[model samples]
Target: MTAQYDNLATLESWNDSFKVSPHELPGERQMRARRVSGFLRARQAELPVVPAQEAASDAASGIADAGRKTAQIEREWVSAQWGLVPRWVKSEKDAKLRAPKLLVALNETVSTTQAFRDAWLAGQRCVIPMQAFYVEDLRGGKPVPTRIARVDGQPMGVAGVWECWKDPQSGAELLSYAILTINANNHALMRRYGHPGSDRRMPVILGEGTYDAWLSARQDKAREFMRAYPANWLLANPVENKKDKKPKGLFD
Candidate 1:
């Protein structure tokens, strides 16, 4: 989408707004964390999820038996470590070294800006699955937490890039990924969500029915998938999070 007034003028604005990607500073990640929300704290039950692969497989099968088998099976939610550790990383410690460069991008390969330029061109595309994301309301000065979700309430599939990094030291491999971002300074939803310190930016939430295209699309056409999701299709609710009571500091 073109500049929405919620824009920061740059194609990729640092998420200066209170809105933060679950992957961003994903503090205290797990060896395996449920893709379903609330895995962070024991506040709810994990839900049976329809894995995107199964859905695609069912659609592609066309065979009656395959369809029947798919109908009888339910996929569990995905469990992935938060935050991206690049393919070249040697260990968690090493990945942390690259996080500042690989964690997120304004838009992968756009204007050759992202550090993962070669990987992006090689079609190292992935999707981040989420129920809802949190953002801070900075407009009022003091930060207020807000939960943001699709108005339709379906899980969001955010655009991202992924790669496999093998540790030269131990031959162990790690899979990591990062969310793509885009300017949203003029967006009805985002402009209203962030504080002046970080207003008008957001992740590149993909459009409905675009998941497969994102994964399989050729690199030259990949940027086509970077379009901004409309703000009206989303809603933000003010919420509370006392678990980490540390008062947020500037540049947090």
Candidate 2:
């Protein structure tokens, strides 16, 4: 329910903070890295390469350059949309907007309820990568934008559900994702930094140990794992907001 957050950094910084292995990179990151590589290949083909005396060295350097570019593009893309969706979704527009709002609530009652059951049954566990997240805080009479991040400045993953949907009109496929929410564990932080409204729900912050089980455990197990972690495990800080000079980070 709180809105103000301070940690905002590139996903690479987050990866380093959490000690996330390349294999642990979320599916969204892989999709983006592939897209960047694809674009670079297409561009490279369009622009002829110069003949070099050190062909092997040139090839290695070219590969490194491509990786740097891909990493940059991946960072930008992930920063813009780090949230997840169901793999079946064909496009964001084709996704079901009702029930859980993909940006905040993790669809515990709708898609996620089913997704948790399905993922547990299928034994397919997953993780969501987030550098920082925005929340709305009520201040005086207006909402403020707050960026919430880990205290150690690590990128964190909230439990998530992805859905893939097909467009009936274009027949294109799209993938979307949602975050799960539960009652706030940090009441003091919620009152001091969260939205002033009575609604104080928060995204379920999963521990590293529980992530795999939450992603791949059976339905019963996943449900048990969905419980919230201790409030002290998370650190909330005040962030700047432009809407109000003294505005808490809650709204734009």
Candidate 3:
């Protein structure tokens, strides 16, 4: 979802591409990869035999449903403005809210403050699916926009967290999500384009194999899987700002 604080063109493009239908909400858009050999081998070594059907059903019904059911939940309508007021927030209908943009700086001290600390501590892991995400670069003092996605050209899931808030008056529930960031991995293409620092923060990319563990309410395993993702997995490039005065190509 585009936030109001973001550039209008950026917001419009996001809404147009993502929120096409009335009931359509922005779905997660991160890249997905098959389970790598290492993780698969490790899992196989760890769990040699499948559990009984009944126990397996119970675990899947409980935890597996969390992610899927949560995914089906929708946010209340708000102007595409990024603010602290979570989509799930239902109290104070007209209250003017202010919040940081969803894209957070990982190493910054503010990230460790109350706003994010609780979710992290609570083992609240989330996945932000994105068709694409934007990045800015300066060339001759002009900000250039780049669209980043998977080299294999698939939607990606940036790790995220969801907060459920209750409306003080009616006791209605609201759910909101946020993207997590960490230092970038060293990839040759990202370096060549001067995309940003290898240390520059990026979304916590979750591998497909780990989706179950990450989404599990089991905090310990989820935390262990939250380590930074590999750099070589992402591909990025410049794109035209279609919302601008003239439809310029990436070179512009």
Candidate 4:
């Protein structure tokens, strides 16, 4: 599974839906392996101020100004590296080598996995806001990317965990997070994706009402929210290029 996803485009959506403001809105609309946005608890009374980055054409494009905004004491939006970097990492070199391998932590073993166990036990949970996530359908004998999103068109809050790793020599801090995935071997919609003979898995997409609870839930209670989202509530469409509806040799 690629585990790639898209992010919110407007500041209003972040404010109205998630009820938090971003420290720095990600420049890229589609979230990949680098720095991405995440919603987590705020421990400070004051948030930092960054200059707004926008042009006159921003309104025409329907994209909001990339400005720093305040957040509630309970929750805040922060940019974190897509991969999880455990605090125990001895060197920056080791961190880079280990991050890619730790992007998705299995819910079944998160509590025991050394890389994620500390974050899980410490209740460092977060919500990854996304417009949609892409999955590959291999039934046709070749990978075809499919975009799965909520039927209501609202952003999805995928469950995750964050950590702060400090460089021993430079003392610089690296904020990182990882998506928590669950087995989808029996899922109605998700089971249709992934390799046919292998075990299928998907990110834990949290419900609309569980944002705050998920960020603060104890380890035991957090597991209660790891269930699969209803298949009917989601819609899937095969990604197609604008120039051509059908790619050359895709079906041949």
Worst lDDT run of 10 residues, candidate 3, spans 35-44
TM-score, model 4 to reference:
0.82
Candidate 1's residue-wise lDDT over 29-128, tens digit each?
2212211121111112332344566645644553232221212222122223334555655466766566545546667343375456655765666666
Cα distance off (Å), candidate 1, residue 151: 1.1
Better of 1 and 4 by lDDT: 4
Best by lDDT: 4
Clash list (residue pairs), candidate 4 = none
TM-score of 1: 0.61
- Candidate 4 C-alpha lDDT tens digits along 73-158: 47777778888999999999999988888888999999999999999998788888888999999999977889999999998888
Those runs of model 1 whose alpha carbons end farther than 4 Å from true positions after fitting are: 1-80, 90-92, 108-114, 195-199, 241-252
Misplaced by over 4 Å in model 4 are 42-73, 241-252
lDDT of 3 by residue, 48-142 (tens): 23335544454556434332222222222221212223433345553234234433424333236555555556554454445556666554466
What does the lDDT read for residue 150 in candidate 4? Answer: 95
- Look at candidate 1 and tell me the lDDT of residue 147: 71
Better of 1 and 3 by lDDT: 1
Per-candidate TM equals 0.61, 0.54, 0.54, 0.82
Work out how many backbone clashes candidate 3 has: 21
Across 109-202, the per-residue lDDT of candidate 2 in tens digits comes to 6334543444223433344555555566666556555666667655566664544445666776544444556666355554444545455677
Candidate 1 positional error at 148, Å? 0.8
